[model samples]
Target: MNVLAFFTATVQTTRGLWRIGQTILGIIFRHPIAGTSIIPILSDGRIVLIRRRDDGLWALPGGMVDWGEDIPSTVRRELMEETGLELTKIRRLVGVYSSPDRDPRIHSICVVVEAEVEGKMEVQDALEVIEIQAFAPSSIPQEPMSHDHYRQLQDYLNGLTTLA
Candidate 1:
């Protein structure tokens, strides 16, 4: 590996690297917008979920933020990109989830937000999503969810916020 890549990886584990990301997010993205994920709740009290085309596992519809994107905008953009739904109300920031192993990629962080829908919901990103449906929170399938999406849902269910 290149010396700088090796150095950042090595030094990233040092005591303050953890907070560095939060600090950077706080400064640049304007609220520690580590990354934005969204949980879209429908009017019937069911939450919208989707199965990834690549992995075929259910997950909340979201993706990485663009370099200059803010959290709120990123959440909206990803919601539209992944599920074709627009967020009308950001109920709350569900939490932040970042475990080294939570994502397959290194140095990747995710922010989870819960939102209410204002318009129609549809499966638009057919290339990236295989299935879309509204599911009761109580009936969520036990089958593994994509990228620890199940865990994020659990965190919301248990009223746990700000996971790291």
Candidate 2:
């Protein structure tokens, strides 16, 4: 190989090895995270979804469980932060997803819930959410969603409480 080509290949190899090393270290040092994904159903029977600023794909409105906070509190906080809606009631537990590959950013167990919500629909967290919209069951977007949200929604729609 020419000198320039050999140098380019060496740098690429080093970068790839560095990423692999980081992944290994992270797995050894870190633990699985806990989070929530809410299926926010308005009184009118529409579900609320948010367009994430990170990937620009629509996702359920929920977030991680904070320190000293339980799942129910996380659900309420995330619901308001992402959708600007008040939680009238947590109607049911949809599922608990714990696959290591569920969230690309980290190994997270997501507790999905169906909640009755009220108030105006707005994007409260501009840093994380781009836009917020409510969709009827038949009107939800058909495109691929971020994370395992598609599966979560399907489990709820099918009336099956999942543990995965």
Candidate 3:
């Protein structure tokens, strides 16, 4: 078999086992609420990333959406709040992933969006982000992602096939 097929089969087998474990554990514990994350992109092709406050790891600048808020609005608001940039365009909706143990606090439905920045930004949320940087897609970190956001980044960079 080809490498892609082999990798996909392995992932499917692993995810199947993970789901079974989740079913057993969920009998006693409840999952956490859902959240959102945006992969902000500049017109020049640079992707926006932030240094997380809790850990000094880099990730996309996004957070949970408020109750009753729309996904696109959440992306726009998050981009503005975290990076101080207003998005000119919010791209199509990517796919959703729920691996049961992806998040430690709760089961989060991360709504990811690709967007283009309209202008410059100055990060306003001083507590959540330590620094903001724009890097080419090829320069992203390989491991130790801030909060599983890097998974979304990987999905996005890999033609967004799985996540889109």
Highest lDDT scorer: 2
TM-score of every model versus the real structure:
0.76, 0.82, 0.75
Encode model 2's per-residue lDDT on 1-164: one tens digit a residue: 99987876776576446545555655888977778999999998999999999899999999777669899898999998788899999999999999999888878788999999999998766767999999999888876999999999988989999999
Task: Summarize candidate 1's per-residue lDDT along 1-164 as a digit string, tens digits.
Answer: 99987765565354235445555665565442356678899877888988888788888888766667788998888788678888888898778787756755334578898899756777765666888888899998675888878888988878778767
The 10 consecutive residues of candidate 2 with the worst lDDT sum are: 15-24
TM-score of 1: 0.76
Residue-by-residue lDDT tens digits, candidate 3, 1-164: 99987876776576446545654554457754456777888888998888878788888887665558777787887788789999888776555756666655456667777887867767666656889889888998777877677788888887674542
- Report the C-alpha displacement of residue 112, candidate 2, in angstroms: 0.3
Better of 1 and 2 by lDDT: 2
**How many clashing residue pairs, candidate 3?**
3
RMSD of each: 10.8, 11.0, 15.1
The C-alpha local distance difference test score for the whole of candidate 2 amounts to 0.87
lDDT of 1 at 76: 88
